[model samples]
Target: MPELPDVEGFRGVMQRCAGGRRVDGVEVRDAGVLRGVTARRLCRELQGRRFAQPWRHGKWLVTPSDGPALVWHFGMTGELLCAAPDDAVEAHDRLLITLDGGRQLRYRDRRKLQGVRLAADEAAVERILADLGPDARGLDLSRFLRLLSGRRGGIKSALTDQSLLAGLGNLLADEILWRARVRPDRSVRGLDDDELRRVHAAMGRVLRSSVRAGRVPARRGWLTGRRDDAEPVCPRCGRPLASGRTAGRRTVWCEHCQR
Candidate 1:
């Protein structure tokens, strides 16, 4: 699954490969990966335009052009790749934008759960983002606490709720809870100020490191690295890890470390 960090990486790819380059052509190999726009219209709209600055909010990537902005959401198995014109076409390559100077930007997805959207203008782009809460990276501690202050669901559920706080997925929610030493099933209404502060700080730390790594890096010292072990144990305390489903998502936590 592509989360905030992975999408951020994709934004980097867009910047490096297509920024300031004129779009020579738009090839829609699979129209199923497009939303709200026909293949012919997409090609017509973007054929002569140039990509300006690229932006990312949560797991969504937006590339600004002279006309409509190109927005993308990489679902379960989607990625944006930059390749030479002569490179072999990938099996799952759904959309291809040929740029000037012989470079091509490819949108590839295996599951095709969520795909591309063409926003008519800046207002349309804002409309697309209207349903999402403040991005996790830009959310301040005060607002973060306020968002969770009176929430009714479990902590994990609250963290993973896109409407409440966008960009956190299952791995991120579990990792943040583990680092905060809070159980995933604990209710937000029952949490104390110290616990909230711990969670806020952990979110910042995890997002920073994960964005730099371009994913939720599974290191030996992190819970993510040990969760799938034969008999998972806490990396911090060496206690057995507990596994269960929270908010309908698989969750893992350290029994001793996260109380």
Candidate 2:
């Protein structure tokens, strides 16, 4: 699945390929990926309009045109591609937007799990996004602490909850917890201030490095690199990592390093 860093990378794709470009045409290769709006409505609303700025909230990306905003959520296997107009459309090229520069911006998804939608304005955009909590990259220590102070779920659950904080997926949740020396199964409400502070700091550190690298880096020094290995061990302590499910997502953590 495409997480925050992956979406951020797609936002960069939007910036370089679609920003400042006028919509010459909207081609729905496979309408299966669209939500609510039809191909005709999408073309009527977006064709001829220019994409001024692209924005992202949580896992959603907003491409503001003269009228409706194009929202994208890269479900399990969604991606944005820049290709030539005559370039052979891949098997998963669900939608293609022809830009003014003769290049095409494609919405590609293998499973068609999630893709594109059209929002009328900023308020409409907010309505679709209101359920998401504070973006993880922008969260502060005070707010992070307050949100986790009274949660009853496991620490991993609280970390991955979109209502508590957005953008963290299973891997990030496990990575952050392990780095902070907090157990994944611990109840959130029972954590001490020290643990919460460590979590906050860990989030910042992880996000900064991931953003810089354009993905959740699976470095040898980090648990992410080794969790799926045949003989996975914590880079920090050389202790073996364990696997289970938390918040309904498969999880991996270093028992010795994380509490």
Candidate 3:
């Protein structure tokens, strides 16, 4: 699934490929990928308008124009691609927006689980995102502590809860907890102030590097890099890594290190 870092990367693609360019045309090859708006209305609303700066929050990408704004949620296997006019279309290219200069922005998703929405105004946009909590990338330590204090569950559940702290998925939650030296199954209320701070700091560090890399980098010495090995071991302590379910998602952690 595309997470926060991946969505941030897609936001950059939108900015580079379509920002400030007039929309020459809109094509919805698969109307099922659209949310709330029909194909005819989408083309009518966006055909001639110029796209403004694109932004992202909690895995959702938005591109506003003079009229309705385009919002995207890249469920499990979705991506936005920038291509030339002559480029061959892929099997999952559901939507295409032709730009003024013949550059194209394509929405491709194999699952088509979540796709696009057309928000009529800023209020509509807010309504669409009202259920999400603070974005993980921009969360400050003070707010982070407060949010954690109010939640009750295993630490992993709190971290991955979109309504509690948006943008973290299974992979990120596991990676952050591993770095913080906190067990995934540890109760949220069981953590002390020092542990909470460490988790917050670790989240910051992980998100910074992940966003820069445009994905969770599976680099050596990082837990993410070793989590999928045949017999995965902790990159830090060289101990065999443990795996199970936390928050109903697959979880990996170093028992010795995290304990």
Candidate 4:
């Protein structure tokens, strides 16, 4: 799934590829990937407009134009690629935007679970994103604790809840919990102040590293690197890792390392 780090990378791509450049045209290869706007309207609204500085909230990417703003939510398999005009299109290339400098931006997704939305103005954009909580990357420790307070769900579920802390997905939740030495099934209400602080600190470290890598990198020595092994073991303790569903997502944790 495309998480916060992945979306941040996409924001970088948009800034480098099409920032301040006028959009020449929009070609909707698959209209099914568009939301709240038709192919013709999308093309009409975006054509000849320049893309201003892009923004990202949680997993959403926003590219503001002179008129309607282009918002994208990359679902499980979605990605935005900057390609040459003559670059071969892949099977799932859904939307193509031609830029003034002959560069092209492509929205590709295999699942098409989420796609593009054209917001009429800044208010519309805010309305669209209203359901999301404070972005995890910018959330303060105080706010983080407050958000977790009174919540009765498992720690992993709370971490992955978009309404509470946006941008955390299955892999991120597991990785953060592993780093914090907190069990996935641990209840938030049962955590002490020290444990909460530890989890908050771990979240900061993990997000910074993951954003730099443009994804939750599966490097050796990291929990993510070992989670998929045939017989997964803890990177720190070498104990067999536990695997089960938490918050409706496959969660991996070290029983010994994470209490």
> Please, what are the lDDT tens digits per residue for candidate 3 over residues 164-190?
878998888888999999999999999
Give stretches of model 1 more than 4 Å off. none
Task: Select the stronger candidate by TM-score from 2 and 3.
Answer: 3
Q: Report the Cα lDDT for candidate 3.
A: 0.92
The full ranking of all candidates by TM-score, starting with the best, is: 4, 3, 1, 2
Off by over 4 Å in 4: none
Which lDDT tens digits does candidate 1 get at residues 82-157? Answer: 9998899988999999999899999999999999999989999999888888899968899999898778979999
Q: Flag clash pairs in model 3.
A: none
RMSD of each: 1.1, 1.3, 1.0, 0.9
lDDT of each: 0.93, 0.87, 0.92, 0.93
Candidate 4 pairs with clashing backbones: none
lDDT of 4 at 152: 95
Cα error, residue 91 of model 1, in Å, equals 0.8
| Least well predicted 10-residue stretch by lDDT in candidate 2 | 144-153
Report, for all candidates in order, the number of backbone clashes: 0, 0, 0, 0
* Best model number under TM-score: 4
